[model samples]
Target: MALRPLHPSTTPLFVAIFFLSFGALLFQFVQTRMFSAMLDYHLTFLVVSGALLGVAGGGTAAAVMDVRARRPSSAQLSIAGAVATIVALAIETRIDPVSSGMFVAAGVAYVLGVIPVLCVSWVIVRALREAPEKSGLLYASDLAGAATGGVLGYLSIGTLGGQGLYGVVAGTALLGAAALLVPRPSRVPLRVGLLVVAIATTAVLSIWGETLAPPRPGPFKSDTMGVPHEFARWDPLARIDVARIGDLGDPGHYAFLIGQGYAGPRPPALMMTLDMGAFTPIVMHATDADLAVFDASVLAAPYAVAPRDSVLIVGPGGGIDVLNALRQGVKSVTAVEVNRTEVALMRGPYSEYSGGLYLDPRVHIFEDEARSFVRRSPELYDVLAITVVDSFAALTAGAYALTENYLYTEEAMLDYLGHLTPDGVIAITRWYRDPPAEIARTVGIADGALRRLGNDHPERSIAVLKHGLLGLVLTRNGPFTSLDMQRLRTFADQRGFSIALDPLAPGGQLVDLASAEAPPTDDKPFFFDSVAVSDILAGRAQLPYGYAVLLTTLVLSLTMATVFVLIPVYRGARRAAGNALPPGTVVALALGIGFIAAELVLLQRLTLYLGQPALALSIGLAALLGGAAAGSAVSPRVPLGLRSSAVASAVVLLLVLGGVPLVTSATLAAPLEARVVIAALAALIVGIPLGTIFPRLVAIVGQPALVSWVWAVNGTASVVGATVGTIIALVGGFTLLGLVAVVCYAVAAMFAPQPRT
Candidate 1:
């Protein structure tokens, strides 16, 4: 065998690390995603995610820059590394790493990214440059460590508390140190004997991170960036993964993830179903069979009058109310849900044999956002039950989702009375951390509206909610109510509800619907949407001083272009600098941008086309996630940078181009076609570029030192670009931004002159 160079080929090892780091990154992302979805203000997560990535990118770039320059010995780099590590530590100490907002979050992200990127890049470059013979081993080692972090991080949430972020930071830091201290025969170890000092600093910070987590209902705190869903706590015992659920006071607000993994059956506990929680939480608990036969099931339950009685249930997820109605022996149950993903999950799992029940004949699930469904559904019921909304916290999303429309809309009252037979009863429930005075006003208003409904139909609508409130409105239509203190005693005993609902204040009042037109659109009624959800991912979205997160995003996006595409392409172009793109890439980027544009356009159109924006977005997102997952799994096997990747990328582009018209298919699920198209586009975006980049990156990097160093710089550029992209979109909307993305890709493709093999 021939003698090897100082740093051996460790490409495999680096690949392994990339693979491993993905596990951790995936876990972290999943946790953040779930938390974002359940939060009251999801924009908060977006800010935080962007912040963290921004910092990580910057930090990686800085370190990589030092390594690429080959300016110092391992010793000098080590000293700088230690100092950067200390800077990171100092930053952490200066600010609590738990808040989520504009300035502070941006600062922390910037600091974290700059320091680490610099440090890690330095260490890896040093390792390869010094022990050229062991370059392969060097890559393998980095990959191993990253992989460990990735897998363990996600699977460890139940056990880890607020220490996960610290764990990542600490581990990354320690690895940098190890890389520095390795045999540097090529250069002397810098005489910066901060080893003991660094170790001491680490020990102190570890202790602080362990003890500094705030108390329950904490105004601010940290949690493990672990699991398929991040678990945050007001108290450790009351852990919930919701978006922006608190502003300190325990009674202010709340939101939580209700379902288990995949499409598993939701827990049907008494608290979950009729209590305050996600529809999945409530429906999964109450529903047993699929929707088709639910009418007969709920009516046959011990509490109903007759098997054929009518039943109405609002808010669809698992369609358990439909099942309950079927159990009750009702002839039919009209089920409605605001989110469409749940509907797709039900049908797919049942029909595709993915592990859910399918329909035979009895249940019909209507895919409509609850508000529009109420306005349009012509069906009426004997027992009207609403198991939606958690209005306990008005400052949170409850203000919008559980507004006057659900309570006092002219159409809602009429629909309730229209469906029920004589003496039909309507029941509803919600959790109240603090039943604001507005809630009492709501009760009175709903009564007044019911009286108006009774002025005509008069079957009466009774609303019952917990936290000590019961509303019994008597419409002149009939004697539907059956109670007082005596009935309360029996109902509470039988239903296992605490003695929290006592109907006394204004038993029957008149409502003024004309005056209560819509939920106030002022600051108070603002609910979380996609734009808002992005800012709250991991802890707070703060950054260290002197650094701007938006600046960082722009920096990283550009850096990514430079490191992975632009610079490398420029260098390649220098070899053939004036050469034009092969034309394939131009087509690819153009179509790619088109695909992204279509996703947003279709989402906007859903409200007008199908009367449901949330549902379309949900289905689209779910499918996109699925596509990305598949792409990630398939990429490596194809071998990075191969002509195969280029071909695959071309095919993906072609598919996106072809699929645009079919997005509005005339099938039973014309709505679903958009989702599938979105999924295909997402996979193409992630896979084509990724597969193409890595192979070329391996070639452009040339040596281990270059590989480590170049990655960081690119990362930094990407952060900057991303911020710029977000800003542009905010100013001009998705159409303009999408065009920009396409342009960027086109410019890159035109300039990147790859030589034929």
Candidate 2:
């Protein structure tokens, strides 16, 4: 008997799939933000891992259901989406930030968060298997929706807020459910009523859900100290809080103001906390009248000699630096800040107290990451000041040892030097740490940059001051002038500030990276990323705080991926008719691991260029998926041999390796528009060949029953790759990971098996 196609109408299924893909990506974006707030930013890797695991589970579920006597309906998948939306909403509203019991919360999030992703994955896998010939087009549609979802996610942050965004996610899922249901001509009345209710419910929630949602906790709020903050705001980037203190207990403790997380030495006039323990003041500045107090002025020392024709302050939290520049009679100031919410707070509630410093005519503010802003700016500055902008939580987060810090690298220092005038000064301040490894790191990085600029004697061009916090000043052309020396001596004498290093002074070199005490570098970059290697060696009962927790998370994620992959494969092997372990399956697993590892490195590198994680993730994901779609769509038309595809992929890998430096340089030199163009083009170029292989493998497999199994294999392998890649990076940076990816692709290509025709 002649029957309709397995997936039914192309148009309706495509539309439903578009909605499914859109909703899934949107949910992922929201979840990432929410979870990062609850945990920390490093949870991003785990979030991706959880979502991938969901995809694998969905594929497995689809395979199991399809093999049954009665095939599961699309309506069931749609209903799952609806339920998932509700569960997500509940999770968002009910859960509080778990500072202590984080693992428990992470587990809960992982289990619940995977559901909706599983629903969409099941639907997508089923759709692909049903119409294998149209796999490329369907894949393209899925990716296109995902790409658009990234833009939507970025917009939702400001437009909807957190609660409102969840409502949007729920509404999007509901729309997908309706799309899936609408095509069922047999159930018009039920579908109509259901669709109407979903739409109405979504609208009500989207418009007013935030009002009903519970208030989120401020990250910096002290549990012991019941003092209410003057102002506070939370965003994806960070939780910022501002408070005023009036504990005039001692006259020596008379600082103008105190900020949480400020990391610097207490100025002479400012009787602030000198301990470099955990809590550091993020911002503190003297009043305009007290600007002349040298010992109390850490940042202001740079402008003592250099003419402040134009001043550029990176990481201007609370606009204190801008205020200092204005007070010092600087002609112009440009402040670059990364966090949007922080900038808004500084311009809003925090502005009034600072005398509207951010709104001042001479002050030009740009909400951009520090390195990115520095790279794109055309103007040269007499003084460049980098105040404390360290993420303490991230520093303490053990697993993020491999996490990229472009701002502290040798290349980054060179870029900063390139933007400075001939006699310009670069001032950097950090909380003093014992063993003084950070000092060594800074000096080494600056010296390297100077050496690149043809400066033979880098030490003579550097000066340092250590009172409570550490301060280092790097000069562009030569040693500090006579005026600079006089100003520094008077400043030190006025406030009990000891000069750590000066070419004219006693101390030879402030810090020596060549002295075996250097912390970490761009190549060996593990500033705050040391795992408890010695403890693991000594057989300690529990791992240290950060390493133990992160290692456990990694082990758990990898184990889960292994279990998810093996169970379905084992089941499928028992039931699968011809050659249970097919050549295509091997190809899928290998390609899956290789592609994701390569892609992860690409995304991290792009972050350095883009200067923000959100932007990097959005652009990198879009370009990668979009390119894959293009390759997949074209693969069927131009069928290449498996060996040829592998070779092409290797060639692309080589291209990526060769092109990274070019992209890095271009990003710094190019204008904003050009930088985006450069990044997008690079991502797309690398994605095409790798994308072509999987679709070809799928086509060659020739068995519909095994499609979902292959997908599960691919997805699970990807999870393993992503998880293991982090550890590898922790050991050997992103370069080694990229090399691993390249090798995986090459080996997979060599191991390519002939499909059973």
Which ranges in model 1 have alpha carbons more than 4 Å from their true place?
1-6, 9-102, 121-154, 168-212, 215-689, 694-713, 724-743, 754-757
lDDT (10s digit) by residue, model 2, range 289-341: 44433225566677766778898988776565776688677899998877777
Alpha-carbon local distance difference test for all models: 0.37, 0.65
Which residue pairs collide, candidate 2? 261-282, 262-280, 262-281, 262-282, 265-469
TM-score of each: 0.43, 0.85
* Candidate 2 global CA lDDT score: 0.65
Give lDDT tens digits, candidate 1, residues 173-250: 433434334446542333133334445554554445434432111111222221122123211111233222222111
TM-score of 2: 0.85
TM-score of 1: 0.43
Q: What stretches of model 2 exceed 4 Å from their correct place?
A: 1-5, 69-72, 97-100, 182-287, 290-295, 304-307, 339-353, 376-378, 391-402, 467-477, 480-490, 500-527, 530-549, 574-580
Clashes of 2: 5
